[model samples]
Target: MSESQNVIEIKDLDVRYGWGRHSVQVLHGVSLNVAAGCTVGVVGESGSGKSTLAKTLVGTLKPTRGTVMIDGVNVSSVRGADRLKLRRKVLQMIPQDPFSSLNPRHTIGQALAEALDPRHADVKKHRSVIAEWLERVKMPAEAMSRYPHEFSGGQRQRVAIARGLIPEPTVVIADEITSALDVSVQAEILSLIAGLRQELNLTMVFISHNLAVVRQVSDEVAVMYQGKVVEHSPTAELFNNPQHPYTQSLLRAVPGTPGFSIDPGITEHISHENRAIA
Candidate 1:
């Protein structure tokens, strides 16, 4: 994809955690791009480095090697105050666990207000804007006065989405955003996000392990395994004609699709070369 068209450009990104013998590199030269106004769904089983990639984009975790450019700012190289500025203006991350990411001590209004202007997230002063955002996420405007513990799991997730988006950042990284909710609530939240995404023309990297969910929200899809992208293609094409063994198996694992259930015997033979898919 052309740089001019892409809001996110991640090239040869290598990320490692810990040090010395204990160190583990989770991403290996993984590269991908997200076009402006499009949502790219990233799917992988546990330990696939999906969350790690989200952190890299949101500027919380820097790439040990290679580069990550978000909305023309190179997150890998920017540091200190500059890094904070990038996070504040260029991008935001909606973490998987709303309870953990949201401050239990802070009221809903205080949280959303702070997202807009951390120093001035004064609920009293920014009530109008915060209320508007809460309503935009299908939440009641009065929710601002409530606490995180007062809301249901689904509602908290909505608040989380509002918080991430109120900044009006150039791009968003939604990491396993709906994994914890029940299927019914998950659908409702997805519908809410879909409407919001179009209204905002949002550019996002939506991370999920559920193939069905990815298919529902993504314009394009990237399949990761053992910290590498095995296949990256348009949503329809990837589902119809998966090329990688892991990807093919993944499609089979989905309900209502042909070859629906994976054969247990082949689970051990899913391949380990970690080769990049063409």
Candidate 2:
């Protein structure tokens, strides 16, 4: 996509945790571009830096080097009030664990209302708006009065989704939002996200470890290993012809693939391919 059509752009991003000698690099010279109205799946295993990337994009964590440009503003350069405003208006994140993310003390209505933009903070004035969003996420209007613990896992996630969209952000970063749910519930959540994306004209960055889930929802996919993006391409193309060894290994590791094996030679054979790609 053209630069003018891009909503998210990152270049040479590097992230390190801790100070001095104790520091460990988690992301290495990562780069990506997300076009407006497109869903890009960022796929990786545990500790592969997918969640770190999501945090960095949402301004919760700053990168050690490189730039994160969202809707023309450099995230790393913004400070204080500017950063707060950017997060509130431009981007929002739906975390993996809804039970932990939601405030147990707050009613569902209160939580959703708090997430609305300041201008819409008056719960009384925006009752219709809150109801609209709840309906959009397939929740009942009466759910507003209930507390988080009163609902099931899937219901809480639906509430979480409603909260994330309350502000009408341009970009939504969903970091493993469905991983905690059962397979049937996972399908329901994914279907909801797909429909919401179309109805709201949303741009999304979906972070997940499951290739099957990624393939189901993404228009494009970026495969990460260790701390680097090993492959990025249109979803179908990458699934059919992965150019990187790590990606191929991941595909082979998927359950039920014929002749799948934990062969040690696969890694040895792919080392040269890894070097070639690097």
- TM-score for predicted model 2 compared with the true structure: 0.90
- Give per-residue CA lDDT, model 1, range 175-254, as digits (tens): 98887887667767777777788899999999988777777789999999999999999999998999999998887675
Q: Please give, for residues 1-278, the per-residue lDDT of candidate 2 as tens digits.
A: 79999999999999999999999999999999999999999998888899899989988788999999999999888989888888877888998999999999888888888888565556677789889999999899989888999999999999999999888888999998877787667767777787788888899999988777787779999998888998999999998999999889888894634322233332333343335435
Candidate 1: list runs displaced more than 4 Å. 254-278
Compared with the true structure, the alpha-carbon lDDT of candidate 2 equals 0.85
C-alpha positional error of residue 276 in candidate 1 after TM-score superposition, expressed in Å: 42
lDDT of each: 0.84, 0.85
Best by lDDT: 2
Task: Let me know the TM-score candidate 1 reaches against the reference structure.
Answer: 0.89
TM-score of each model, in listed order: 0.89, 0.90
